[model samples]
Target: MPSGGDRHARDLIWGRKSDALRDLNRRRVLRAIMVSPGTQVNLAKFTNLSQATVSGIVQELQRENLVVVDGNDNERGKKVSLSNVRGVAIGVEVSYDTVTVAARRVDGDVDRVVVDWSGRGAEHGSQAWMRECVQLIGEVVRRTGLDETDIVAIGLGIPAAVDPRTSTISQVAWALDWERGMDPGARLQEHFPGVPVIMDNEANFAAYGEYLYGAGRGTETMLFVKSSTSVSAGLIIRGLIYRGRHGLASEIGHLVMDPLGVVCQCGNRGCLETAVGGARLVEQVRGAYVGYRVDLPNSLANIVERAKSGDLLCRRVLQDAGRNIGIALSRTCNLLNPEKVFIGGELGRAVELVIEPAIQTMRLHSLGGMFNYVAPMTVEASELGLKAGAQGALAYALTVHHIRPN
Candidate 1:
């Protein structure tokens, strides 16, 4: 016999699913309008629910002034749609080194912004910084002329392992201690009250962003490599972001290179990041120029500039890092054999210097047969640039899956 606790848990799952379903239907209707502006979604496309249910919900939404009928189909005889009032969703991406805030108008048009936080995760406390992020979101909403009432949800991205089903972030990312067990989705509730929020790892969101609006467009499968202040990877299959059994699939930074290597932030040893992470690379460069009166820039852009200006030392440093990174990617590619590879983030800006060696080394170490199919694996820069994570966060909010607030 089932116990009361089990029954309650089942009820919880059903409730969450129902709520998610309703949220999804709303988004689908809104998405149809956003794409065509004047394009109308046939009322029948919303077959996930009963006709009565869909009609009632659509009526409620119409009553709220959130949606409007653009016009009825005259040729084939169907309903048409256009968002009467723009609904809004907020997206925040908190990386190891920066904070980016953007406001998306779900109804009429889309707009976004990216900001680099001077205070990093490992430096100031996460909670203190989280409050700052909340404040920034408010500013974005105001600047965009979006009313909080129209914001159905907020999506957030962090560079850490997050359990998608349970919304329970992994214990491995101790580097971001402040976010541990904080329930990122719940935190936004404290600020927005009735509004919902969704949070995920930056890499997963980036992969989705690229799939929807960036390099992965029209591709069946894609793998995104994020080379930044810290490093991570995301996998997309059939246009869906794949988070492993424990929501820890893309923890490539912790992929051990040498069993006896240095310790990783995840308590592992000799991770790929230890060899080519931006911070690690910077440290190595600093070590190389001990007495040359040379000082390194705090950001990767400066390094790229110097490398572009004929600085042999800078070029060598980036190339070596790329070589190490490529070695790591080569091993991963052997396992997945994805169709395309897109690189993004800070270090990614120097793909020319780093990518060639990375690919050369990756090819040099890989199996011969894998090379027979695709030519050079189509390595390219991120089309989304800095907004990749934010775009992904908003995508998460709009999707049916994920443990985000809504």
Candidate 2:
């Protein structure tokens, strides 16, 4: 119905649209590869693009030096990953007595270090811990063979509630002893310029880390509970951290278990923290052995060690703490319907002494129907251990856009 000129015009328009779509698909392929190394088949599934589309885009990206392919050229044989032209990302986790720093390219092993600063209090030590943290991060990056200028993104995980919108600490996290709304990332930025910083609660990052690279891998929904000096939980729903409004979504430690129980740092009484926090467990053990032949536990870590060495009192305390944790988690399981629960923190190292009680308690309180379903709720120890938060921070940094070197 149209002349050659009209047909030519239509052909040009269609060709341009097709080219744009192809470019978009190329980006999708690159993004998938950046997240993790995989074969073309995996990339197609991750990007929801055709194998042919991924193959074509991957070849183009390879030509442009934007991607690196591993192994042979067979479609399912070779693994494809990003070339890290944008530099590496760093993850920092600052606990009450320890700081861990990790650095890595987008898809490889990370260089990490853990430093104990127990006696050097952050608040009382004139914020010297911040300087130490910066130094440790630099050291880790150096181990990765990358200079300071190569840092593109930094993700920080602090032991406190962080306001996502403001990127500052929340008032409820009084244990930090810093200003209620102080931005730790902004403070760290002074040491590393031109790098975008992302921050979140340490437990949240740990949960994400467990989801991405640890015990919660492949789970549709997962919950991670940190039972240390303080009690906290992180929820992952559909592969993403579910930070509710105010960034205080999973503060299960503050759940009022007994209005008449001990007062928490948040000024709340009888919270789950009072019953199962690491400090509380240690205190119970010390009080019980004050005038006995058994030695007193100076810290929760010590108590866990004693439990593993056949200390009946220590084992009972850890088991009791686990049951209490399970009681709190049962309530969480009822509401969130998480598929798996991961136990982390200093106490999680005790494993059976703690987790067994928790699993039993969860069964006692959680809905029976959900457990009867095809996949009953599962409980496991954190695969990343103390490094979970730091690793999660690194993974988080990879997901964000950072300043590129010009």
TM-score of each: 0.80, 0.85
Best by TM-score: 2
**Model 1 global lDDT (CA atoms, 0 to 1):** 0.66
lDDT of 2 by residue, 124-203 (tens): 33277777878777777666655676665678888778887677787544665677787778888888876767888989
The sequence of per-residue lDDT tens digits that candidate 1 reaches over residues 152-175 is: 566778777787767767743565
Model 2 misplaced stretches (Cα beyond 4 Å): 1-34, 41-56, 72-77, 84-86, 107-126, 293-295, 401-406
- State residue 304's C-alpha deviation in candidate 2, in Å: 0.7
Question: Which pairs clash in model 2?
Answer: none
lDDT of 2 at 289: 83
Model 2 TM-score, all chains together: 0.85
